[model samples]
Target chain A: MESKIRVLVGKPGLDGHDRGAKVVARAFRDAGMEVIYSGLHRTPEEIARMAVDEDVAVVALSILSGAHGSLVPAVIEGLRQDGADDVLVLVGGIIPKADVPALEQAGVSRVFGPGTPLETIVAYTKSHVRRR
Target chain B: MDERYLTLSGIPIKNCYRPDDTRQLDYARDLADPGNYPFTRGIHRDMYRGRRWTMRQFSGFATAQESNERYRYLLKQGQTGLSVAFDMPTIMGYDSDHPKARSEVGLLGVAIDSLADMEILFSQIPLDEVSTSMTINAPAAVLLAMYIAVGEKQGVASQRLAGTIQNDILKEYIAQNSYIFPPEPSLRIITDILSYCAKEVPRWNTISISGYHIREAGSTAVQELAFTLADGMAYVEAGIARGLAVDDFAPRLSFFFNAHNDLFEEVAKYRAARRIWARVMKEKYGAKDPRSWRLRFHTQTAGCSLTAQQPENNIVRTTVQALAAVLGGTQSLHTNSMDEAWALPGEKAVTIALRTQQILAEESGVAQAADPLGGSYLVEALTDEMERLAQEYFDKIDRLGGVVSAIEKGFFQQEIADASYHYQNRVDKDEYVVVGVNRYQMEENVEIPLLSVGQESVRQQWKRLERVRSERDGQEVRRMLEDLKECAQSDANLMPVILDAVRSFATLGEIMGTLRSVFGEYREPARF
Candidate 1:
């Protein structure tokens, strides 16, 4: 069998609201992924380093505190600088529809908001993750 | 050929309830008369008729002047008290200009950096007349000190000021995660606040031990009651450990809870909270004062219950939750705006939210009685069961060596995560229903005029901070910060020194930064 999809769920910036992060992390685990959690208040450099160190195939970012406008792009930049550019990036939590296109253009594979079912996220990850 | 009924918390419900369900309920011991011991009915004799619950809408966004306008407008629209929601940067103890606060200044709440901002925020509003509640934690002592300094500026002494600081740090570690220092230093700061407020800010509620975030983080109603009471008991113990008398600070310790969609379960949870706290204070802690036994709490309709889709349905959800709060006998309430799930509520949405409370108070007559659902068999039975269910958690937490130890062990975090995931899984499978998200089919082109926050406040707040930094007596600011750090290093209460720093125009970031250097920052180990 193929190795389980390795994913790192990150909470960047000063946003401590992690209900989405924890719940989605649990969902990822239940879907048989090897999950790594970036605890609250992680900086972009720290998250990218963890993604590289853990050799995770995917990095999911959760930000509810409205700092996603700045934090998300910083993490993407950090990953590129570290030569982990091919790692799939996903975003969730309180991103307005207007901001989606920019995040997508910046290398985020998908963006989920409030009320998304866990199965949808799991299914999407399984189908899209580039396993190492 | 069977149908299953369940509450939002996943408690199985009977098809019909009967008097036999509560046959053993003793009116005297279990369900005492209002204002009596074990106040399961209500804390006051005539709830809302004698003095109605305070309508304190939580509002703040952008800079001081703009937020002041919103506060004045809410007051003019008949809001009885003020609840300030500080921005995440302010909430995390950073100046608006701090690089870490980029793109987030004045996003969700108002940015207050110094006594100058506090003065402008509360300008033209009398401190003595209007009681204010600040939803601030982590650096609560500094903010409270600034408020006291503002009162002094207004000729209102610290003694005359009345309000609450959500100085509850334990909940921040468990759920909110805006915590700065680790558990030990945080509890020490809380103890200092309790002791300081007991003497200086007498009318001020020192700590609002909160369960609102716990519920919002997806715990069941029973877990909310259990964990909250656990945190409250931990505070009371901390005060006692500090050699302060129980009654000295216990009476002022208040609670804040979430009014979720489970009407009967939520009511039962509140009712159970009162009974449990009363007994714990009287019997376990040896608190002699009746005020110490009486549980006073404020309820806010659950923000998590509201949906981004079909936002209008949130009005109905909030109304149901508000009715539950009123029936459950809350001391005050804040009805959530229908548009909150999408953004900070627009003026029209917040007004309707406030009006929802007014209509209930005026037209619905739900507030006429102390405990409207006090006699229902289902409610009584559920109230009894809630206590029992909560007892299960109390035992587990006690075995884990109290709230702090459990938090260190990630007990509460894991439990809440499991509960939240369970709930979402149910909704995913159509086992449970959330109105707009799952049950109702609708193609929503939502155009609710959102309260759009802009970058202007960031510029405004940065300029104000710059001016304050330059104009203040830098020598005195440095001296006060040194004194505050020295005080934080000792066992002496930090509040008095914090007040001195605030008077010297020491910014919140400066004060918190000083303490952070001494106490160190808390980093929770992340796990699934």
Candidate 2:
């Protein structure tokens, strides 16, 4: 049997709005995937290091403070520097439609907004997780 | 035919109700006249007939000058009170120029670095004439000092300053995650503010013990009530432990609650809240003053309930929520704007939000009587059920050695996380129907313009900080921060030193940084 798919859920920057992050952590767990939450107020470097150290297949970030334009790119770059760029990067929060194409161009696999069904996220992760 | 069933709190409902539901209620014991003891019916005898609840719209964004213009416009639009929302950096006690604050400046709320910014934020708006509520925690003393300094600049005395500082730090550790200091030092700062404001800013509410964030973080209504009241009990215990008299500072204590979707259940939550608070303040703490016993609160409609899918439908959701708040007898109310689920509200959206309260006050006759649903069978039974559930939580919290220990053990966080997951699972399964999201689907994307702040606002904020730094007396600022640091290390009241630091033009970052160094920072456990 294949080992459980490990995923790291992170809350970047000083954004304390973690309702989505916590719920997604539980949803991923309920989906039978192992999840590691980076807790709150984590820097981009801390999150990237955790994703690399844990050898996770997915690095999902939740940002609601509208700092996604800067923070998400920084996390992606940190992963590149650590030679962990193959990790699937999933973003969630109050991301604007106009910013989506740019985030996708910057190596984000998907950006989920509020009210997106949890099954949608789970199924997307299952189908889209980068194979080792 | 529609399938009907349970309340938002998972309370199973019956098809019909009768007088038998509330047959055990004693009007004299459970509820008296509106203004009488226990205050279950309502706090005021006449309720809105005597005076309408203040329509407070919580808003702040861009630079100080820009936010000031918004406040002036809101006042002109007949908004009864001012509620300030600070930026994420300001909320986290960082200067605008800090590396952590780079992308966050003025993105959500007004950015304040020092007294200079506060002066501009409240410019031309006299501090004494209108009441203001600052939704600030952790660094509440530093921000309150800025408000006092602004009041002084306007020639308003501290005695005449009337407002509430969101000084409830326990909730910060439990829910909001904006806490700067450890729990012990944080409580010390709150206790000092309680005694200090009791003497100086007598009309000012010292701490707005808040359940608003708790509910917004996705706890059930009962958990919101129980944890908030449990936190309130902890503060009272802290005050007494500090040797302050209960009646002296308890009267100024206030509460903040969230108005959610379940109208009847929300109303019952408020009624139960008031009765539980009155009994605890009078019976448990042995307070003689009736004012100390009364539970006064401000309510904001639940932000989590607003959907980002169909923005227009939020208007109706807000209407139901605003009506519930009024019917539940909230002292002041904030109805969330339609665009809030995506970003900070724009001018047009906030205007509609403020107008929601005005129409409810002027057009709706629900406010004509005090507690119109006081004797209803369903409402009364719900109120009792709410009270019973809250007691169970309180007992559980006490068994765990109170709220502080529960927090240290991450008990509250785990409970809230579990509940939040349950809510999400329900929504995902379509067992819970959020119109426009799960049920009444909308295919076309919304075209309403949202308020988005670019880097220009951050540059504007940085320029103000540069001027504030270049102009102020650096030596005096250092001296005041040193005094604050010393006070933090010792048992002295930190408020006077904080006020002096604000007077000396010490920035919020400097004061909070000084305290952060002395009291240390908090890092949450990485438990999911």
For the second chain, the TM-scores of the candidates in order are 0.99, 0.98
Q: Which one is best on DockQ? A: 2
Off by over 4 Å in 1: B1-3
Instruction: Give per-model CA RMSD.
Output: 1.3, 1.4
Relative to the unseen true structure, what is the C-alpha lDDT of residue A101 in candidate 2, on a scale of 0 to 100?
96
| Docking band of candidate 2 | medium
The model with the greatest lDDT is 1
TM-score of each: 0.98, 0.99
Per-model C-alpha lDDT, please? 0.91, 0.91
True contacts kept of 2: 0.80
Model 2 ranges off by over 4 Å = B1-4
lDDT of 1 by residue, B105-190 (tens): 88889999999999999999999999999999999999999999989988999999999999999999888889999999999999
Docking class of 1: medium
